[model samples]
Target: MPHSLPPAAPLRGRFDRFLILGAVCLAGFVLPLNFTGPPIATPAIAAELGGSPAALTWMTNAFMLAFGSCLMAAGALADGVGRKRVFGIGIAAFGVASSLLAFVPDLFWLNVLRVVQGVAAAAALSGGNAALAQEFHGAARLRAFSLLGTTFGIGLAFGPSLAGWLTQTHGWRSIFLSSVVVATAATVFGLPRMRESRDPAAAGIDVPGSLAFTAMLAAFTAGVLEAPARGWGHPLVLAALIGSGLLLALFVRIEQRSRRPMLDLALFRYPRFIGAQLLPIGTGFCYLVLIVLLPARLIGVEGYGALQAGLLMIALSLPMLVVPFVGAVASHRVPPGVLCSGGLLLAAAGLVWLGRADPGAGWIAPLLLIGIGAAVPWGLMDGLAISVVPKERAGMAAGIFGASRVSGEGVTIALASAALATFLGAGLQAALPGHAGRVAEIAQHLGIGDLAQARALLAPTLDPATLIGVYERAFGHLVDALAAATTVTAVLVLSLFGGASAHDIANTHEAPAARADGRPERVADCGAHG
Candidate 1:
């Protein structure tokens, strides 16, 4: 059934607009909080649930995979149905899922509930954002989105400390319960006052494209996450990796054939657009992968409690709160190519510094440096994504960028985790040559900061200090690889951005009709900073 806009009078009222922004921001806040909090609690959850390494990884990956995969589809649904309605349903569903998660009996159910929460998160994020777009225009829209971004940053920055306190004080489950409260508040405050609006001409959901994309992401992430335990040569792991490629090919074909495709494939023809896509992938490897890995290492390997681990994480995440504004401002004076590539180069250096630093006390400076580097491009990428395409196709640009950012984060984190686990497993095998078969299981435990469990599983004679040393060495190797990957990405992005010429900049500003072919004539240049 189609929905139409409600009365303009109520929506125009200042109070209603405030309520709408507040509600949307609240939802935005919870999503990242939920995302970042779980990794901090992974050790606690493991201590009780006693899950396999793959299961532990799924606890986080399942939510991210579902969240990233469903985002575009959720946006389409919100547009077709009522944005307000979709937002309400999403927030309500998120609350229900979160409440259930607080009491989840095992890791299986925890991951199952997380998937539900992720779908809810997708609905809430897309619906709320779309609704906000309707509620505000021009300057107000920019300010509203800015606040929304800040709200998300605050949550991402502070989630670890808050969740750590909760985990230590109440239990790991309290973290979910807290989200339930926030979700309820969002629904109650925003839904009733918000005006209902829908795009009457919105395209129907692209089921084939959606399924293929989601499956591809899930299959690839699952294969990576499972590889540490199952081995890269395992038939299922090989099948999954191979199937992901096949799914990708099918997805491209489906998108090409669709009448109103979810993704606009034509955009990829532009080099600038391709470079814009690389921004998130670079940050994913350099920044997001660390967010998941660092907390576990601090608590389990470094002997910090959950609270201490969370406090330490603030060094890494705190810069996200302010450095993005620096990036935004620097875009004016510094060439965006310089700013972006420089930021990434800084991050690469920081990663190397971090890998060499002593385990616990020597981390803060490098963590802050990495965060600052990542934040520089983080703020610019969204605006850059929109500006790279024609104004008429801005929505498509946003959707594509959004999908790439989130999905790339999930895939990169999974790949890095798998590599780290494999490295750790190899170290364990070398040390305990007699029990080679159990190396993967021990690596799994050690990976999540369950050092006690890992110690128990291995030979009784191996000292705790020796095991910690092995884990640290493996982690350092992983960090070194991530740094190298980020550096390569930075070079490629710089080269791509360097290709832009003054003529291309002028072409991006020209009206579509100005071109002979009726398409945006050329890719954008650094003027994308605008």
Candidate 2:
């Protein structure tokens, strides 16, 4: 059933407050469950399905690609049609997709199912975030967002250990089934208690803008993910890269001209908004991109079991638990710009320290430092995405925020994974000096990450010691690259922050409300619609 929009009203809880908070928690929990859970299961999935490294990358990227591409459109639909209805449908669809995944026959089907799940996620996640911004206000709004932050933190904290133990004890398929159970429970808890809400002023969906955005993201993602296997100069890959650029230019042109654009290009005028959008890219580079690789590094290279590897990942996610509390204090006292700048600086430094780690005891400190630095700043950005805009546009703002963060994670993962495979291949060629032909075959095995099998295959052709040396060197360089990316993000964010503190800029640049005739009003009155 579809939800209908009524006249605009003050932001208030039409349902039980506790139920509202509970539903928001569920939405937040699912974010990391979908993204972070799969990495823990990747090794097991690859072994069972015989997926190539590129195929395995698609298993994750396909979902993120769809999620990022669909987010703004879904958010716009929620604003015009109904937030609760769209959100409930998304949750139901997500559960169905996860159930189907348990029975997916091959890697191809698995990737397709993941895309479906990602599309569903865009609705539920953005709607839930928008709902929070629409319902709560003042201190309660701050508290609600903080709770939302902790929920995802808990999800990321639980994902690795839970997914690893489940995959090891049951099988890789159990991971999908587990997600089904969680999504079902969230749907049940949310639908009945959730209130229907919408922006009456919202224009109809911008079909061209939506299609163009989706195509642009899809082409770009395919280009990056396939470039490693198909050479960078391959015809299809080159076409995708060029096509994505053209689509991006087209999307920009459309937004600039559309009467009611899906993405309001005016948002970019605020330097603070631009700065807020960029922070997610940093988090994706410094934190999420690394999480995806840690399990492979630990279980594949260091001889740890799945469960043990999952446990080791706790060092990175544990600090996430305290993020909301850290965020609460920072949001109330410090300027957001200052907090973000300082936090990213600390995070970049931590990543540099982590890059130099030698597969030993000293690795723990930098991991914890990076985790804290990344997670705490993330909490500040959660509310700013909605708060910076007029209350009527919360859904739009939430969608863009979701797109930025999810797309950053998706694209960064592809880049990181591509780099990992390329470097490893070069290292193997060096290690297997006399066996040039065998090097290619061994590279394929290692690239897809059947590392134990690669070791076995190489033992007959080269010295075992030399093979281990190659892995260590390749892995060290990958971490160095990740460190470099984070440091660059830090420097860019610092420049974008400019001179104003977050508190000052946010107060001065609050989005103006639009009149019925589409003229802008100067009131900063949040109680009017937000």
lDDT of 2 at 15: 59
- Model 1 weakest 10-residue run by lDDT: 510-519
**lDDT values, one for every candidate:** 0.79, 0.74
- List candidate 1 stretches off by more than 4 Å: 1-18, 136-146, 387-398, 498-530
- How far is each candidate from the true structure, as Cα RMSD in Å? 4.1, 4.0
TM-score of 1: 0.89
| Tens digits of per-residue lDDT for model 1, 482-521 | 9999999999888777644323432455233113322233
lDDT value for model 2: 0.74
Cα displacement (angstroms), candidate 1, residue 434, comes to 2.5
